[model samples]
Target: MPSSSVTISSKCTILPDRNSPIIKTTLKLSVSDLPMLSCHYIQKGVLLSSPPLPPDSLIPLLKRSLAATLSFFPPLAGRLSTDAAGHVHIVCNDAGVEFVHAKAKHLFVASILAPGADVPSCFKEFFVFDNTLSYAGHHMPLAGVQVTELADGVFIGCTVNHSVTDGTSFWNFFNTFAEVCRGDKKISKSPHFSRDTVFNSPAVLPLPAGGPSATFAGDEPLRERIFHFSRESILKLKLKANRKRVNTEILGKESNDGWRAVNGANGKANGAVNRTDEISSFQSLCGQLWRSVTRARKLDGSKTTTFRMAVNCRHRLEPRLEPLYFGNAIQSIPTVASIGELLSRDLHWGADRLHQNVVAHDAATVRRGVQDWESNPRLFPLGNFDGASITMGSSPRFPMYDNDFGWGRPLAVRSGKANKFDGKISAFPGRDGGGSVDLEVVLAPETMAGLENDVEFMQYVS
Candidate 1:
């Protein structure tokens, strides 16, 4: 608690109305949901312009919209529980979500939007979900929303336990809520809670595998900073990576030709680059961040450093689940490389490495990963991942700006308050909704200080 701390202005719970509509049965969670049992809630917030009405008018609107939205997405209003053998499931008891109304005296949306300004601490309080709510307690609300009014803007904070849903499902709920707020009688896409089809029975399968590791185990103090990458910069990176790919391809061809000339035989290069070798904006940004963080930490060249990424498995599954399928449907892709290889290689080298991991996760690959996970059910490997690791959550491709709750689009989308994971980074679309990207990175103070002055990294980031 420092002078820059946020104070609570008001607090209250918003229950689903008696007729708000809810599912009566308890929905069994798949083994896929077990790994996140102890991880912090998935929290996120956005700053929007204050509606052109009395500040108090916003609360009633939010409450009404939430009640309506919950009718379509009832699991969020349910509570989590565990059975005798420690299996977790959601009880659709209509327990309801918590809502809060607050004001930050000196905080303005612009102050928060300003470049390099310290992230306001009130975001955590604005979103009212409790990270400490355990399955044993049986009183936890799976989702909550909070709105904090600043002098010139408002912050909308939301928290959803990772066990209940993934990013795609999380944003789907918000989009539906926004639809309700705008007076739409129905949501565009109804959520499909078909957990049965997505995951096999737990009796036959072992415990779930690949959940988040214990709450960010690093002991070092962490600092967070938001960095913006313009559409132009991102394009330049993709173009550079492509050019590197072509050059590497050409060099490999030449080396193969030379080898053939020396020996009377034809040999293929180590997978020559093709049109399929193209990279994505996410891979490009992660490449830049992983390299900069490695150099900033000044990790020893001989040690192993890993870049852990979150992969969405909705469409990657064989009989792909519907776009609206609820609950955890994500897998982890951890790419490991020695510091010497990561730092000494060109940006495209990192970009290509990350891109390959993403490309390899087709339907068959996803099935195998899940099968292995069910067979072994281990915590998603963080690589004993310490300062030398870079973990990524969220994606720039997610429809972040579309959650228009009757007001203008949000100025920025940010990860929620419980973001304590070491070397964690969240990606959101830039405000323009173009190809630009916004990265929210968390690192140790010294590493953050080094990253701030990292000339190569800052060159691409605005």
Candidate 2:
């Protein structure tokens, strides 16, 4: 699709409904939120079948409901502020959010969901605030939504400041907006805005005069593709990862043979004593991806490869946060190993490594991570800095397909070209559900070609 194929019909700012009582206040940025200051806004959205009504009829309904939703999420309608100490905070002054209505009648849903098609470049144009960093929220809208009308469907794309919302909070706002559009009188889950649980003191961290620099290295051309693994395929991978193995002597010497322990405190694999614990489906799938991507890159055997998985800290903290806690509350836990060791190991070995790291990131470790950041705050080092790392964001467990705004459930979930770099992966629940998974993989062009042709990887892609 050419740029001329899509045209923006209208753009407006949406404020909270006047009927709702909204007080202007400031909300402190949590320890988890500070690192994202340099990151780009998260651009994600859903594709739905054509609505019963036309765009003119539906767009107004969406805008109206969005205003009501903003009443419940005051910070979203606010702007970022910096104090003399350079500490960033959200000022809830009803600054309003941007909403754009667009038309792309030439594009169809089939072209996007095609069996082995590269994600359409036109999808990026469906979102606003291209390349806008999160810190720009000081002047720009903290969030924006674009509704593009397709030939046979509609795409609702959203761009939100990463510092203010993680994948969890992003979906929470979307789900709530959908509910309001569906005429729900009561919010199923209200957001918790308290930052006390994130830290004790007013965790202050100053920033550079010009603000943090962008960490993404987009010099190399990249390819983005969505690989779907069916429910049965995921189950098969999990079963293989969990299959009982003979406690061979070789296993006992794993630690001596380049396999570093996941836990540094005890110099032993965390949760290794409970070998019977089942490997989660997520761990198994990610393990396969790590191995396949490594092979695709064709890196040197001695090169170190890292897989970073964003873990939700809300529940992992000592005092569990309210499930509805409404801000960034996630951290990336990296699992590292040499390419040779990772590729040579069995699926279970890699899966076990990922499982151990996740299990070891308990409350104490979470607190320690916070303290370390308080001591020295810096932006998240995103992108494949070493050309040998994969950072996985988003999750298959998020309620992605539930954004039914009077229209039918969404047919698929897609993302814009924000915060994308080589080795960046986003996971979404398969449209068919039932434990299925879809991985939106971004990689160097050559590596992607190799991955597409790799028999081992293609064999599991459904």
lDDT of 1 by residue, 165-208 (tens): 77888888888888888788768989987666646447322333
lDDT of 2 by residue, 1-462 (tens): 334267999999999886334466788788888889889999989898999987778999999999999999888899999887667889998989999999998888887677788888888888999888898999999999999998899999988999999888889899999899989999897888887785533667667776777888656688999999986566566666777443445334332322122111111112122233566667878888889899999999999999988877776666787767888887778999999999998888888888888877888898898888888877888988888999988877788898998878999899999989999998887898766778999999999998899887788899
Assess candidate 1 and give its TM-score to the true structure. 0.87
Model 2 Cα displacement at 299 (Å)?
Answer: 0.9
Among all candidates shown, the one with the greatest TM-score = 2
lDDT of each: 0.69, 0.81
Per-candidate TM vs. native? 0.87, 0.91
State model 2's lDDT. Answer: 0.81
